[model samples]
Target: MELSLHIILEKPTAGVAFGLQKGSGNKYETVQIQQTDSGNLDFYLTVTTKGDRLKDALPRFGGPFIQGPYMGNFIYLDIGTLAGQVSPWNRRLKIPMAGITWEIIDQLSADVALMLKTNVAGTAKDGSPNCATVKPFNGWRVVSK
Candidate 1:
């Protein structure tokens, strides 16, 4: 079967980048969203899936936060659960995605995705962060495309 997971990213930081990987051991692939006359900055993540059961079919998600030459794991959504959600789902993420600066991005690791802090991207070094910040994102919605 073929299905598309729709992800709506509202106005995000110009340079900040985030994206999702289909499953483990997979790289990111971006979907092009046509610009509207309103001139809003938006992007989409359409996860193509196949399977008879949604639980068995949908794979766990692992995203990345990228700025300049630095990249770190951003978010993780493990599916196939009774809750059928990862965290902070269908709601605004509290943290400012803009904090993912090049100055501290390299210090982040995939472990940040585990913290599941709706707003906090984890603690940075010194005044350390356990998570890597995303860009200046207003909001995001993941549905079906």
Candidate 2:
């Protein structure tokens, strides 16, 4: 039961498209970026997964955000269910500049694969427990046109 997820950061349109592909299945459960808001650039995602169309997964799955050092930024997707819980499926995606798009995509894909493997194996990937006090991503560069 291998699971793979891919996210394409659409720069020109300031949107994102991601899909989860299970083993041997060409079909993918996709999440399209419907809208973005100020303050952490919270993504309002429309998810179609497992025969369910979730109009908004943010409320349940937690919205993703971006933050990083100068000249680079990374998006973080929190899969944790609630505060003070350990999240095995948390994903951190780096937003690449125009020149390094392919590299970033490969990296993110690998990360997603590894996370899925660990989750399926029922092994805990050591990490700090999710806390509410942590500050949200301050930079909101991605804007909708």
Best model per TM-score = 1
Error of 1 at 45 (Å): 4.7
Q: Residue by residue across 1-145, what tens digits does model 1's lDDT show?
A: 1112233333332222233323333443332412222223333332221222334322222233221211222333221121133323221222232232222222222223221112223212332212233344433322212
What lDDT is reached at residue 128 by model 1? Answer: 21
Local distance difference test, candidate 2:
0.25
lDDT of each: 0.27, 0.25
Work out the TM-score per prediction: 0.25, 0.20
- Flag regions of model 2 displaced more than 4 Å: 1-64, 81-91, 97-145
Residue 56, model 1: lDDT of 31
